[model samples]
Target: MTRVSDPSAPRIAIVGATGAVGNTLIDLIEKRGFRYRDIHLVASARSAGTELNVDGESHPVRAVDEFDFSTVDLAFFSAGTEASRQWVPRATAAGAVVIDNTIAYRMDPDTPLVVPQVNAHELDRRPRSGVIANPNCSTIPLVRLLKGVEQRWGVRQAVVSTYQAASGLGHPGIDELKDASRAALDHPDETYPAKEFTPSLAFNVIPKIDRFLDSGFTLEEQKMLQESRKILGLPHLDVTTTCVRVPVVNGHSEAVWIETHGVVDRTELVEVLAGLPEVTVHDRESRHAFPTPATVDDPDRVHVGRVRVNPNNPRAFWLWLVADNLTIGAALNAIQIAEELVERRTL
Candidate 1:
């Protein structure tokens, strides 16, 4: 196994540095104080030569084909599955430990799909393939909150409906929404753009996220169920999800119902979730007390609220959860894993 001897200062590379997640990862690495001896910004051919400022220094972005990955100690990949599929093997062969954000390897039995706060222990086995998988943006917050509950009361089943933001598709999705919104405002009857997201998304919501499977669940929805079970080590855990694309451009929100094996107590649920360092519970009787998708902007915590036991089933409870899909859900989670590797000296 290739291990990074010096945790304080390791050479780093950022794949798809021109993307939203890649940009956010650069900021988070600096904010979290992960020291790096050197940093390389890599993108596609079109994005090459673009200058990106990191920690007061301007780094020129180079095409992945032109960049050398062998010297870098750690590489964070967010260039989509196609790019990841093409470069990940080359990177691993060149001795760089890859933390992939794309779906290319998340379901691979050999690749450990992880959210550090929830399943850092899985990293003990290390990566024989030199690749670590980051869960989907929708799966991160759900699992983060479920981890504590699964530990305390043993969750038997969970159902989630996610209000995903336009940011899930990066800048293109955000731009499409904005353009459609403007067109609708200017001409109420005219048809606007429908590119990234199917069926208009400006002043509406789409119930589908990724391609639909024969099971009637979209790929994005199935990810929530499948990835949750994997990270929590509950193969039989009954999980269902419906992923929706909302107009919001920052955070993702979910209305979750969970059934535990034992009885559900509201007070105990709040205490257990609040005790987690990475979760924040904001619940009350007031109208604006619960968390909203726009409220969690670039946050590190998974905001959970509306904690209550279902009247029909004493063993079941409902929760409203919100989180920044770009940060805690993506970039920050990857950074946490890298930091964990450093602290454990496993990278």
Candidate 2:
């Protein structure tokens, strides 16, 4: 955390400052005491003129089109894929390093798709494309644990099913879930029109997230596979996923089944996971010890539980994980990238 008053601190801009992840970014900057010479908040035209507070000072939100990218040293783009696609190049061209939170630049050959816990070394130098891409929410937690497993016992393959929250869609998605749930409870016969999630997500789980690919997997599922490969530097990694949207408002959970090349010892497995940077493993010592999205105490750390190796197949094991989609998945990762850049003098 650099001193805000220091003349050398970066001048930063937060695009999509009105959205869920954007708001979380502001909160984290305050909580972590992230310093900057100046901070600008930018959003769409509709959200312009609105005021948001950072470090107890009020700042007016500026429309992205009107804000000059050259004014900032670093810009974080979380608006959307289209927004990032439209504005990221402008920001980078203006000599501002961009940390993008969209899918636009993630798979680009020159852009680094980063998860700080797994690969902060990637930020040792300025990116060739002048932008760093954050991995998907579910992919972030999965890859963090996978890094440890792949090092301890070579990972043969991984199968994951994500129980993603409505917050994955941002603020509107949460509103729709609450409205749809209320409609269902008050009037059981009527259907609540679902805009964020198709066929309603109230008291229901939809197995499809994002759109369907020709290969029968949704785009969200595809992102997990592709992003995991890029972040871990495993091009041909066998990671298959089924992404589902649950009714919860925040926090994404995953049930992972990983088969390694060697036999796994449960005691050592727990120790390996527990030793990771910010992972908490709840073993099966108590009858009710696993972490749920609602009960997980820390939003910043990844929570893991249910450590059991298949007795029949000693090479495979099962684990459950929960992480805040907005924080660990999006804003927090973006800020951490900025922190790494500042520390390494890369930005």
What value does the lDDT take at residue 73 in candidate 1?
Answer: 83
Question: In candidate 2, which residue pairs get closer than 3 Å at backbone N, Cα or C atoms, i.e. clash?
Answer: none
In candidate 1, which residue ranges exceed 4 Å CA deviation?
1-8, 284-288
Reference-based TM-score, model 1? 0.95
Instruction: Give lDDT tens digits, candidate 1, residues 139-246.
Output: 998888888888888888888999999999998988888998899899999988589988889899999999999989999988888899888888888889888999
Question: How close is each model in CA RMSD to the real structure?
Answer: 2.9, 1.2
lDDT of 1: 0.87
| Candidate 2: regions farther than 4 A off | 1-3, 284-287
Clashes of each: 1, 0
Worst 10 residues of 1 by lDDT: 1-10
What is each predicted model's overall lDDT from 0 to 1?
0.87, 0.93
